[model samples]
Target: MSAGDLPDPAEMTDQLLDEDTVRQVLTEGTLEISGRLTDASNLTLLAVSSLDGVELECVYKPIRGERPLWDFPDGTLAHREVAARRIAEYAQWDCVPLTIMRGGPYGNGMVQRWIEQPDDSPDLVDLVPAKKIPRGWLPIMRAVDTGGADVAVVHADEDKLKLLAGFDVVVNNADRKGSHILTTAAGGVLGVDHGLCFHTDDKLRTVLWGWAGESLPDSVVEGLARLATGMAGDLRLEMDEYLTVTEIDTLARRIDYLQMSPLYPMPPRGRSAIPWPPL
Candidate 1:
């Protein structure tokens, strides 16, 4: 199926298109670059793929367009993005959208199905007046806005975001800014921009620290158990396609630690625990 055959994201209650269909359309369909996301750190293009009279809107991040990073090796960000989705899927979480590594007009890159949020959707994470913290919202920290007004960085205490936070821990996501969380009209929550994940070291910076030091819910513990079990099977082999052997081993260890501890991790000591521009 091509992009044209997919239902409009807003009109769908669940996933607009199934993962397998998206994979086929993105891999085999013809791609046309329609626009660019200028705010992204890397070269991110907005594009459409067409195949068999179907069309789907997707984000294209070509490997050649990836910017050099001091910590990450050059040209591997797109691979990491695809790997993140695989890891999340393995953990039995659908928080990451369908992503595939494919050749595009810009050569080899990562292509992910675009998630459309409704216009009236509330921010899953945001900076709000310190005193006006919404009931049930969890405050992560306090800071000043551009006008020097007191503002608190906060996120919802919802299960969808909690699951994503757990997935971030397993992948060692180095950047989990508030804006990375996408809430759909269908009530599905997903995360994007995962090129900075799956690092070999402990770099789990994120805005979802409200659960820090709390015992992980049974659901999260179960997901960790699933991941721990997969480390010895095809999961490791699948991850090896995108991450180095060392990184894969480290990921396994992270899963083991979480299963043993079963608690949300505390912010790392002696390093920033939150990404810059937290929102």
Candidate 2:
């Protein structure tokens, strides 16, 4: 049903929306007539809100509306999006954003709460003027900017990025481009666009190789351990909703490996380690 066709449930606008409220608005809200996010690739991106009264801004990517991909099974990318968020939540790495797979104006797809972008926040993938990397940042790639001068694309080595880096490892994210990391208005970082993930094989392409082989700080290890237990136990059952049995088993193995080893993994030698257009 079109979102405009439904009734608004509450008079919520710019109010802090809890998970339940967000989910309800997404599941039952009316879609804006021109809600589609045109710049989105590989699928339609719809902006929607609950008809009941809450004006929640949300991005909806419907499963059936996806463009075909040779590598992934049809209509399954939306589930993987949800699965990535689940893993992120389990590890306490809230960077993945709150996501729900529910019926929308088009069909069943993934709905994520829109994060407000703050003008003052630093860009995750930004160019620097100097040759030397900054104290708390790492250079991922380099190139010239529009001014025909030297510039380097870098990421800050903050806890927010670190949490996302760890989360990406367990999910085997294949498209961790700089564009995928978003900065919230509150100066926090969050990772998005996780459809290309959770393959049984090792497909961890990303721009986050700055800390490869470094020890995952103790806090990171604790978070990983907590997730490992859940992945092996009840989480495995939930994983079935989005992942194949082989993929779930491999995720469990990754969790175990991360907990025991307690180090960032080395990039495998035989493959391209980072994504194209690193910024």
Candidate 3:
């Protein structure tokens, strides 16, 4: 969808200053504004309370140069809008409606669906106990694995995983880190961060690796096959209007590989895995 299709920020004027709202600033020069919809970013998150009450989280170019790493230009809300729309369409998943909100006390920002944190939240990255090693990845895989018996060793909600995988494939997600997967109190898992996604490269960098060399579950394989066959048609059509032709082609290749090699090995460490916002 184009910028013209997005909701206008002027329409949300009064709600933006609600008293019940809370705002917290996050690292990497992001500000979390609660209560109303605001700007768009490479990554934007908002938590909608009731129907009208909304909380927003936005990641944008850092205003200050204290750390000396931030470099992207400010006021690029249009780029994020395109990425979010393409991802939501390709995966058929719901995304927080995004819009260009006023900048923070610092730089430009974006508003997105703000997800409420679960009451019983685990440390986002430290959930996998040290002893679990690669085994911890099993449960996450099972929750998302779609292949079959030889490949599917654990049990998890398959439908959710399929959607998540589809989102990854569609966005060309380069980073599926542990922290980015949020587990809600309602026992739902949500994926975030699409800024570094949709790149025209093999950019799948995830921490879940237990099923590295194992055959994929039948269901997972089937999902990949479906995506592969429909990619050039339905999926591409959905993304074409929002994404570049090259970006869509990369997504198609990833789906094809997933279908052709049910047990595709993970990319070797150091070869593809790099730190986010690489220094």
Strongest candidate by lDDT: 1
Q: Rank the candidates by lDDT, best first.
A: 1, 2, 3
Overall lDDT per candidate, in order of appearance: 0.88, 0.78, 0.45
Per-residue CA lDDT of candidate 1, range 1-279, in tens?
544665554564324566667787788889999999999999999999977666788999999999899999899999999999988888788899889999999899999988888998889898889999999999999988889899999999998889888888888899999899998877888999999988887889999999999888776788888888888898988988898999888888888988888888898888999999787
Candidate 3 lDDT by residue in tens digits, 52-150: 232234433322311221432333323434455444533445332232233554444433334457677643333323334343334433222233322
Model 3 ranges with Cα > 4 A deviation: 1-111, 122-170, 269-279
Give TM per candidate: 0.93, 0.88, 0.53
Q: Among these predicted structures, which one has the highest TM-score?
A: 1
Model 2 local distance difference test score = 0.78
- Report the lDDT of model 3 for residue 88: 56
Evaluation by lDDT, superior candidate among 2 and 3: 2
Better candidate by lDDT, 1 or 2: 1
Stretches of candidate 2 exceeding 4 Å from the true structure: 1-15, 129-132, 143-150
Candidate 3 structure, TM-score to reference: 0.53
Predicted structure 1, TM vs. truth: 0.93
